[model samples]
Target: KSFLSKIESYNITGKQWVGSESWITQAELASDERKNILQGAIGFALPQASIPGLREFLLSLKPSDEPQSDVIKAFWEKFFDCSFSPSNTSTMCNGTEDLRTVSSDYTDVTYFRAENNVYKAVYLVAYALHALLQCRNGSNPITGKSCVTRNEVRPDLVLEYIKYVNFTTQNGAKVFFDENGDSVAQYDLVNWQMKEDGSVEIVNIGQYDTSVPEGEKFKLKENTEIVWGGNSIQVPRSVCREPCPPGSRKAINKRKPVCCFDCFECPEGTISNQTSPECFVCPPEFWPNEKKDQCFPKPTEYLSYKEIMGALLTGFGCVGIFLSLLTSIIFLTHKETPIVKANNSELSFLLLFSLKLCFLCSLTFIGRPSEWSCMLRHTAFGITFVLCISCVLGKTIVVLMAFRATLPGSNVMKWFGPAQQRLSVLTFTLIQVVICIFWLTINPPFPKMNMKYYKEKIILECALGSAVGFWAVLGYIGLLAFLCFILAFLARKLPDSFNEAKLITFSMLIFCAVWITFIPAYVSSPGKFTVAVEIFAILASSFGLLACIFFPKCYIIIFRPEQNSKKHLMGKIPP
Candidate 1:
């Protein structure tokens, strides 16, 4: 106050230089340097010196000091009252537009206050800059240590600027993002430097690029190239993924990863991953689709040629037996080999039975599996097998006995007289019958369709229960007949008239040869040709019977009419 009082001492109409002399003289008179600070502090209370309504606010900071600081008389600017200022419009204070908006009464005074106002206008900015940057504070644009001039603005003012300063990019600048924090596109490196006048200049020497030593375009690393017009990116030279294994499938649109490719597998019943672009399933009738990847059961309709051949061969064997029976009967009737032989005529009966049995084998192919014939077919086949074997056994025993009788000093011939011969035949016949009954009782065959699989319809087949059973019977008969031929060969040494053995011997040989050859031929031939086996065998056996027995008798009866005597015709001899 003393210094301030002295400053007013010399000033009335003229402003004097009271700062140097008065401050010095006054500070010499004072005990502390507090006078200057106290005087300045109190200066905020003066009228016309105070900031608009700011005087009231500063006064409120020291209610008791109002009398000493002379703050009660401080002028209040109505515009600074905020209540009188337009709402939301005081924001224009940063620019000169607010003055233009002022009422006309204030226009005349603008020029008077303009110069001083300008100094005060930039004072806070400079103070903020200087304070923040630790530089000298002033109203000049150059007064601050750089950071683009700092000492010009106080720290508090800098803070205010930070809050209020709006930033916008100049034309040459652009915004970019570098995820790797490496290079900026075509932009030069910049560094801050303080000018002697306290302004900051960012010196741009040259463009920055680690891609080349100097002045070169950047080349990106692989997998680093952007895609889709900068919408995305991709890794280069990735490997593809393989498909799923067998018996599996993939869902639609299930995406594979970058390093993997999509693949699908066929399902359990359905084969997949075929020869084409996608997997395929096997059709119902055809097994193993295009994939050739899996196996499945084909329909019965697709049976192989061999299967069909087996069926036809079976059919032929049946027809042969039928014809054989007819021929045997014809021979018996013409030769007068009476069916009603008083005692056991089992040999005659077995031959007849064998022929009948063979006929029944053909019935197995009557139709597909049907209820009426179901059980009968198996029984018929079994019986047929027994009968054929029985026939061969009977013939064997007949040949053996005949030869024994012809042998010198061998009495087995008389022991097995006519009745004994018949009994021996019956023995084998009954034995075979018993065997068949036993076989059927132990293991019955069924033709019930297995719906799980397709229904198998037999087009051609043996009348036998099964092919194996049929062959088993043939094997037995063959072994027996082979032994019969050996016996007959020895028996042929006897007188031709007494033995008459060549007929049976040759017939048996022919029969054996036919069946044996038929088996192989049937196996090799297609099913369509299997019928030949039956027809040919029938014709051979029939002709053999006609030649062996009937033809000889017919020759005698026709050529030697007298030879058809009472004994030859009716009583005894084979005419």
Candidate 2:
């Protein structure tokens, strides 16, 4: 009562109270003022079984009856505040109560005069003595005598018999002690439920018996409702921290219990759906969302025509095509002029056509790479460049042959006429065509999702299936360009009237310089920039060839008509 009064003074509420049998029994037996403080508390109690005739014996007590001993007389006088009398007319003490019936205050008691554990102990000792004195065939197996004398009995001997004693009590409950000399553990789960009258009731809500099977030892009444602390229906939590939520992990506090922890969100590119020690990394082609709870497929990236860079490159390619066609128109209109005729008009027109194809091929590299575009981009670039170089090579040879024809009895014109020039261009271009066909048939380029180039996105670019084949095409174009550059260099010093070789030499120099830098830039560039570098190389080289080779002739035919005359070609009218 004093301990419960201390708890009541603290005014602690909403906290579950649990205790052993003695602690709970004290709460149950406390005065109403003290017991009210423990309302809704839960605790364990030793399981009780009703004792036969014990309630009847307690109710049958009367003050008129003689006390059995001095202690009994004194207890009866003190409890009832009256002495025992044989001839009392009233059966109650002080004429206010009947001794034969129990008081209303003690009605909650289940048994009288004996505790459940005390009853079990009495039975345990009786069984041990019974087994100790038992004789078989006139011989006591324990002591090797008909009956063991009381003087021969010892506390250790009696205890040895008590260790193996097994019996059932009057309530049909099996009683036995374990090797540790302890009886089977049995407890009743009790809850202190408050009543409307401000009194508390100790209700048996569950049971726990060690004699039952392992998992079946503890059980609760399914229909029984538990009354939590502070008369609340919800069970109070005693944990130090709440659980970590999804998309997060538990970070344990140092020198604290495992229940006490902090939650940390998953890092970028990793995902988790529960309280885990670590997050899982997303796959190569996947990325984690903002919440880091789910993985999504990475966005595909390519040099699309819609983006600013691709649009700019496409615009440049279109300009190149338009300029090439416009140059062809100018050459056709001035075909009769000395400048156009002097520069070999047939090869000049063919070179413009091939330059237009080169510009158009760069457009193929601008869009999303597919199977057809992948194959066409590289093959078309190789073939068109070879054809363009072939035209230049033929023109360079013609300049040398024409200069030779001016000498006496040279006869070089018959060996290298217009038909031979066309055949030479055709033969050189046909070789590149065959090489492109074999490259496409053996190991062609194809579109691929490049994952290693970036962490958060997929690069949709053309993958060259055979590096050797790709490099071989570039090598073959380089071989033709080098040959053309050397031939043009040899003929550069010829007379200015018939010599277009100097312009060809300058065009080949720009072409070779652009491509020589292109190899290193293409190799070092990353993601979509690699394709941009290649397209820039193609556009720069094509523009160099167009400006260097034809711009001078168009100026002569359109702006300098006097210089386009036969006297200018024969060097007869020098300014």
Candidate 3:
């Protein structure tokens, strides 16, 4: 006992490795700094040590025999020997927290995730930690001193201990909380202010219990109780009418707090920004009036070449096709293109519908998108696409037929003629019509209701019919395009401009390229991009057709008077 007592005094009297014992002249006590450190360490360790499955730890030391080796030996010994030295090694247990449904016993409750709000999480953490701090204190076995976690709102009590809060900013006082049950911190954080209904969340701050048993990191749940006020304030969410996005004024009762304060508007000419933020505005060269917030094109170079010309060309083009078909029928004993009179009858139907295709393409420029106008536009675009491709296919078959007829015993002659051309056009058209019918039967293009749309009165709309229609349309177009490609390749060595066939082949190739590129471009964008896509499509494809089929007509009709013959429209074929 005497021999052991000699070393025990040395352990207490500053002979220990950490030098913490230096001021302990008395056998029973430690200095204030040492006491403070021990108090803090005790604050941390005592809670863990008392955990039912946790093994206890103790400080250990390494001893040396030589006096010269004391400094070197103490350095190595402290590094190696300083540890809790748990007694149990073999037994292992895992602890997982179990959450019980919080009782609605108290009035203090934040709204749950009905709206994806997180205010409840902050308060729950505050309440839980409140209970935990109380559950700790003198209840602990390690700290002999008495401590208390009361209901009092001390700086350290409710707010400071919270994990998600930003205590530094005035508005940051109690702005954030972990709403979901899962908080990485040992204690969850939250904000509670008297004035706020829901919490405005503070983000990017840290938590105390963020580490796991394995020392891995845990994610903080997204639902955190956040409040608005004090050092930091959040911008109030703005809800505005579309089209009248950022600049244009709402005519009558602007749906808002007051005079255009929360009115749904866009600047006169700008469109809504493509990526983020939900608002309305007109883009450059676009204008809207205060009375209706109707988006209209602003006068610019686009005026002569764009919206006006587009509307005029489209309107006149359909009319011209209808008129030409009428005139052709009048000349051919009251009906049909010459191809229909002979074995080439199928080509007549192709020609007729090709005229229809041009007419339909013109209808796309009817007016700004509304329920009725939008439907008309889609109908026009749909018919135009289907018929245009089918006509190209019909032309290709006719060219192939001309070559096949010269070869003896070739049944390709029987496979196609005027009747076959008629059959192909009628069949392809019926397929297209069926696609339209299916679309109309299912979810036909209609006005899509949006709560955030223009003044909540006008519905933002796009074609929302059967996906099958889109697929069918693309398939029909693609098949014809492939056939056109094959025809072009077959006719590669043929003399240019011998007949209109070369012009038709080149036109078909251009049309195929335009529609093929359109597939992905349309699919990748939102419905709002429909008008933009269609405008570009019409200009590209329609122009290709016009250049191939009508440029010579225009040149002759305008410049060469002798070439303009009434017999061109009224020529009677051999009876």
Candidate 4:
């Protein structure tokens, strides 16, 4: 009833039948026509008689010669005609030949001899004979008669024979026991395969030899040899649910076995990489691929000069260089003019050179990062810009002191003369150079591969080893520009005929604006774009300085030559 209930639950509808008494003849058993009726169902019978008929009946249901169908057929064939029994008609024991012959008188009943009956009875008789021989004596010494004494017939003698019984059976089975008197467990792995005649036959796929080591015990043939149950080609599933594959983990079901569980995706930065119960983190310098099943080398990334953003920034740097060169030439050609001479042309020249250096330095930010380039690029940029701003500062101070000295009997002009202008420029530049030296000596920048910011790519960038040193460089330059801007603003209306302070103020304004906007953008930008933004700021500020201060002066020197002369601007001093 329980079997019927289970089959019904599984929707396995089939005809049901029963077997006769155990002692029934083959003809009597075959009398029931229902025994031959094939169906997808279960059967319950002893391993001795029913196996052969059951095998044939099940095979009749499967007309097709599929590998799995053959496997099912082989299972029954192996079960009925097993090597474990001594009465098996086959002339083989395991894989070895059986040479011993059975007596002809018992030939008809010999076929019914199972291992549980005939083989065990043979061992029992052999042990009894051994014990009897050991106990037998011609006569007892004290009794003086031919008799077997009870002292001679001992349990130890029989036990010794049974424990050490190592012999080959008539069926050619080499049987023995271990130290614990337990038989060696061995099993044959069988598979069903289709014969050439369109019939099913049994195949010895492999074996489990317990006498071998544990790892070498179970040996199965190639996967192609084994045909699983049912008509399907895949291996039969025993668990309640399918397994959790790679890149995922299992969530155990409280109501079922551990084999029955739900699968879940692994967490970020980790992977299972195979069917596993838990996930683990990938190694350093490696990242999970798209499937999260395995780790791979992280892809390197940087602002390459070949990319559009990099090319645009580089082109702008080139343009700045061209303009700076042109400006330097224009000033040098009109070096004797009063307007150019009065504005400290030497300082102007150095400032323009520094601007050129700034433009070129920005190019370093747009290429594959190297150790030397990373260290040199930022330090060089900071020092050069400081020099540029220093020149602007010197000019502002000279303009302020020159006008103040002309108004009264002041000796400020001598103190703030051309020589002092050169000294101040040198002193300011040397201070920046010293700061850069200290910064490099202490904790300098170096090339770094960063993986934390992005998941898929490695940002190949320059790491500022010390944040304080970096900010200090920027802060010092900012201070100098602020001072220059303030001084120039105060002296913007001071004798405009010979004053360059108005132009200096506007240039400083542009420079300050560029840097102020750069901070937030640099902070917000991700990956290589951050480098691009910094380069853009550098070019923008350098161009502002060049255009604001020099462009107007060049316009007047080249286009309006009369305005460049001293007589046109006789306002206060002896021009």
Clashes of each: 20, 0, 48, 0
| Per-residue lDDT over 411-503 for candidate 4, one digit per residue giving the tens place of the 0 to 100 score | 888888889888888888888888888889999999998888998779999998888888888888998999999999999998757568999
Off by over 4 Å in 1: 1-270, 273-297, 301-322, 325-329, 332-346, 365-414, 441-476, 497-499, 511-575
What overall lDDT goes with each candidate model? 0.44, 0.83, 0.46, 0.71
lDDT (Cα, tens digit) per residue for candidate 2, span 1-575: 56667777886555677866667755344454544456678888887677666666655654345435666455555556665565364233342345444354333446422376687788888877877778787776755756655677777767878877878778756788887888788888988887765566678899998777899999997899898876778888888987766677778889899889998898777888754556889898899888777789999988989999999999999999999999999999888877888878999999999999999999989888899999999999999999999999999999999999999978989999999999999998898888888888999999999988788899999999889889988999999999999999998998866468999999999999999999999999999999999999999999999999988888877788888888878888883
Residue 499 lDDT (model 1): 39
The local lDDT score (0 to 100) that residue 544 gets in candidate 2 is: 96
lDDT of 4 at 118: 51
- Between 1 and 2, whose lDDT is larger? 2
lDDT of 3 by residue, 1-575 (tens): 34335545454422111112121111123233222221111011000111111111111222323335556344443343332223354222111111122222121123211111233344445654654454354562222324444554465444434543322211121223456534333422222222232222223222335434554443344664333322223523333434344343345455554434433545333434334234355443345555433456543211112466455655566556665465335334422322223213334344555755655555554444456654555655666666766666776666667666767877786777567776776787777777777766776666543323233133244545666766666676677667776775676554322234666667777877887787778676543344445556665776676566445444444465343443332333211
Q: Please give the lDDT score at residue 81 for candidate 2.
A: 62
Say which prediction, candidate 1 or candidate 4, comes out ahead on lDDT. Answer: 4
Q: Estimate each model's TM-score.
A: 0.38, 0.68, 0.38, 0.72
Clashing pairs in 2: none
| Candidate 1 all-Cα RMSD | 27.0
lDDT of model 1, residue 75 = 22
Candidate 4 collision pairs: none
Candidate number achieving the greatest lDDT relative to the actual structure = 2
